[model samples]
Target: MYKIYKFDEIKNELVKLHEIDPNFIDDKNGDYFCIKDEDEIIGYALVKKIENNYLLERMFVKEGLRYKSNGTKILKFVVNHGRGKRINKIICNNKDIENFLKKYGFKECNGHLELDNIQCVNQRVTEGKKVVMSSIIQNIFLAILKITGGIFGSSRALISDGVNSLSDVGSSIAIYLGIYFSNQPADEEHPYGHEKIESIIGNMMGLFLLITAFELVKGSVMLLISGKFEATPSYITILWAAISMVVKFFMYRYKMRVGIETDNSALIADAKDSKSDVYSSGGVIIGILLSIWISPVFDIIVSIIVGILIFKEGVSIILETSNIILDKQDDEFIEKIENYIEKNTPVKNVHDVYMRKSGDKIFLSLHIRVPKDMTVYNAHNLADGIRESLILDFENIKDVMIHVDYLID
Candidate 1:
């Protein structure tokens, strides 16, 4: 089993960080984080909270994972973690990493980007047009944190957990946009309403889920091929895993509440995804801990499980949303509709009932038989009455197209 760098090994790096920013570590009183495998230390990060601002003193990943998404993930975690602390600005002097920071909505001011107004941005994203933006930020942050920890700690299981987060982030934008567009009111061109756009967007998210599943398997394969195990994953990673699990669970609850309040199925799906992440992170923690006492192979097994989960979820989402897109018939729901219509309205003998979805909104088309001798004028009036009855009875039923036809004796 591999091991992390011991205290003596990390001292040299700490000295360098001190030189770069003396305020970063107070020697007797300061904060810094180290990353390591079971064998040796692989990376370290240092930061200082200065009043309303944060200063990133130094961050480094092992040469093997350096310059890869592994390193980027760690850097992203640091940035978001700082933002989460309500830091008005984050200042970093490392010119080499400037480009990475800029890509994540950070802008250079003078020599560095001040992590200022991060709280403002987060507030706006949560409250305004970008209601789902907070989920994106969380996904990216937790994904990188786990991946960086996994890389240095040499825990394949943790990496898999991170990969799961990547899947969510990949699907989040499409899902968010779907919710946003579905909220639009019915117009001249789309009289039935814009809710269908949500269903289409949901279908697109299914594709994203599949793509991310593929990514999870690919990463797992690469790890297995290397056959390098860092046996003694650092305590830091365990701490990170625990923290991420708690945070992810809370996010699931938050999103679920929003979903219920707004009655948006797309958002509810997103919440379920977040809830799964909470458990996945829990799995990562269990794997790493078991590796210490049991056969280190537990990590690999966990990695495989995570991939399977990603694949299963992707297929399920694709099948569900695709059915709506393809207009698959739902006999059970049709029965419910028929029962409701007969009970509430004068119309009888419901037939040709059809249902499909657009976003969370359900559209129904059906024909009902009235008295064969009923007049055309009466039939038209009865159709209007049926549409009104269904609309009032079911909350999600947006519009009903009823074709009046003669009752067969």
Candidate 2:
């Protein structure tokens, strides 16, 4: 397998290519593209911008590598890289490359082959952002309904659940903002992009929920100890609780699906939080029923229990997000990647395969040992192949950085 990249620095192995073939041009005026086979520079292509169009100055494949499809690979890579250019013109003496350029959509225009009228368009908004916005809207609606209903019906459990929903509005807002910022392109200050902001928001929401849960529980406990229970909750509270349960159930399913699909940690946490809301609403209904049939004290007891559940959820979120923030090594994920690299590539040994989660993406860095006699260019190409394959195979993998180590025999 071969990998292609934009060539910048003129390294020793690149110089070796000229030594191997005296005709090889080492022009630095235009953009140089190098195609590597197991780390050796086996082929190259050059493109230069003149006026408003791009000129395909030269394309070549090493003598022995020509008939093996290396030429086609280089042509495809170069064409894709110049897609948005207004006009792509080719100037090549090789008949094979000329045929390839034509087959790849370049047509004879006057004396040179040209591919013209390439169009560039803006990308659509991500699914993660859309889903998070939906969450924020739903939570806001639910918080308003539950708070209004609880206050009018005089149900402590319903009021506490309302506050839970209110807190969810805050959590959903955090998630929305996280997804928004994470989608921004990488800038100088944040080379890795703003993906980690999602994890940080997750942690902050957990802490917020923790504090909210404590206050709710404290309020319920004081009411119980003071022996000043409010009137039995009206039938309206039961209807409101039922409505909340139904809404939260659907919200949970929707968020979980989108979260898994987008691989967004904040969205997943928000989904689980929705699930907790359903359970709390169920408790609210039961407390309302028992208070009407048996005793109003059950209403206060249920609120305390609901508060405990919220606290438990808050702790869970904190632990999960903390692991992601601290770059906790996922042994299973690392093992799977290492196994794939060793089995599918010429890597002699895989080492230090580390990964960290940020928003919906995972960034991986690893070290792999290659043959001691392999040139640095060969090692670099081998690593590039492994990195490309890993990223293509794993959807969540956003980037991979590899270090080449010589196998000590």
Candidate 3:
């Protein structure tokens, strides 16, 4: 039996443990453990309790102790603990971990319905719904706000509204184009598919957001320098801003909900961008009020602050889009891939595991070390099985390539 420690007790040790193996903590939930061999800690495991179910957060053996049955012992300990706690089900993230859990009687549950097991397709559908809904609502609300602003707003208010209107229109067009092109079938000219187009669109959206922020900042500075800031906003401008804030808040919530459900980067980015609009608009409203009560200079200051905030968000979106366009795999995702291979391959060792991402799709490449005396047919079959296992287990994985080599040991 392994020792089970509370999150507090294990958190400190985890810092040290991570230097040896980084994937030893559960990000979602649960207690951490250190498996000892004859009084020496050899590995670590995490058991995340989730609504009467237990998730094996992560299990890792020290590199030197990998082949010494530490992994098996950790699995046994986790399964026994789950049973003792009267938890009927245990979930694991990796396919290899799932197989190991199954050997101890865990069954594959519905991956789509369960949040912990949501597939890529399921996530995409959820995001698509959210984007569609949010886009529609935001467009309508902005149109109304523009009409109201034009009727009763000051020069500054009207100009800001114009910028916002342009941003909304550009974002809508980019989103539509992205969705259309992302779904196109692959052809000879584009073997990897059109998924990267989403990233391109996202980057373009970010660029536009940056430009909008810059313009807002520039306008505010010019207003302040020219002493054009108003001491009071018209009642209609205030009312319109209030209504816009409320509507944008709900829109943000809806889009954020869908983004989390679907893991759609584009939709998630849009949600973030939309949420920023709420904040920006809210600040503008506040600035108008403050300037009315105090001096007109406060309005320019607040607008500058809002512009900086929006620019920060734009930078974030740009960075994320850049990663996708450059085909850079997130380190955590790469680690997950390596862990999956090490645990599931049935080989003596593995190395050079590589992963790349194109939009929501994942591509993996790795080398496995097999026994020298193994038959070529058996090795080929093993490679094929490994690829198929990954495909069946992880829905986001679009492709995998496994290279086999003979191990000297």
Candidate 4:
């Protein structure tokens, strides 16, 4: 919006004025003046020469200085200078600013309304489509994974797949539902979007993995204690174990490929679990074979080994997922954001940066320091620009909050 004017065409002095006060240069006849703090321009004003009166064309203080009466001081300078020039009447164009100028005896001109109806409508339509498409794709993928896993394996195996299938189901449902409600714009119930729901689902998936591990361990231990190993294992048991191993090996590869393509942690974990199942099933097959050559006790020992492996995988999944739900910060992400801000903004420094993660989404908060003499509005606009730029460049960022601070004593 600010780029509508050609800054290069104006006089260097007026260019300086426009930088200080954006509304200062227009077709109206005016003399642009800048208010300096030491060597730096902190505010700007434009006084237009009308037929018999001087109009207060425009005035603006740099963003950081607005709350310090800098605007009022600039207005006073325009009034006093106008009186000395024998200009009795002063006019102000903006109605909102007219009230502030009235204290200096300036009268308002007719109000002007700026409308951007087309832009507003287009933005809403685009946002709506994004929400709809994301939801549909996520739900479809989840259903496919669940159906495929269930049909190919037993119910217990499907359930024990843990981080792979279960995690996918949880994350997909959460993203679909979260986006549906979060895209509803701000309401009384939730001023912020429902993005955090992704984290909740991620945490739930982690817990599910833990449960799955426990059940697998319990089943393995029960087999060991039941003295089932004392009897000679049947040929059917070895045949089934061989079949399960082959199926699981292929499933492991397929799940791993999908997980890598999607960059889904849950899916990756599930893929690992499938790979582990291949080994465990193979172990069972070997244990039965060895019983014929060695002793039945080897079968019981192998079962215990499989149980321990399941327990370890469960603990790993819980730790990773819990970190995400707890909003643990990633140093790499913070460094990326900091580098972006320093490169794009006129900010002198950035500090107190905080990052929060909810599943794959990242939230950022930081303080940016600019020159001390700028007005509050200018500082705010700069912060807004930084926020907008980050969202455009980083796909995973869900929200950002910036605090503007002056770089002076």
What TM-score would every model get versus the actual structure? 0.62, 0.74, 0.66, 0.54
Please report, as a residue range, the 10-residue window in candidate 2 with the lowest summed lDDT.
117-126
User: In candidate 3, residue 266 scores what lDDT?
Assistant: 73
Cand. 1 Cα-lDDT:
0.68
Candidate that scores best on TM-score: 2
Looking at candidate 4, what is the lDDT of residue 1?
5
lDDT of each: 0.68, 0.79, 0.68, 0.56
Q: Write the per-residue lDDT of candidate 1 for residues 1-93, one digit (tens) a residue.
A: 111223443466666545534544433333444433332345555666789777776666665666555455455545555554767777878
Alpha carbon deviation, residue 91, candidate 2 (Å): 18
Clashing pairs in 3: none
Off by over 4 Å in 2: 5-125
For residues 344-396, could you state the per-residue lDDT of candidate 4 as single tens digits? 55665988899876434567899998888998976776686577556545756
How much lDDT does candidate 2 score? 0.79
What candidate 3 gets wrong by more than 4 Å, as runs, is 1-130, 155-162
Instruction: State the lDDT of candidate 3 residue by residue for 272-342, as single tens digits.
Output: 87788788677777776776777767657876877787789889999998887787756787777667666
In candidate 1, stretches whose alpha carbon ends up further than 4 angstroms from where it belongs are 1-131, 185-191, 260-263
Superposing all C-alpha atoms, what RMSD in Å does each candidate have to the true structure?
28.1, 7.1, 13.3, 15.0
Model 1 compared with the native: what TM-score?
0.62
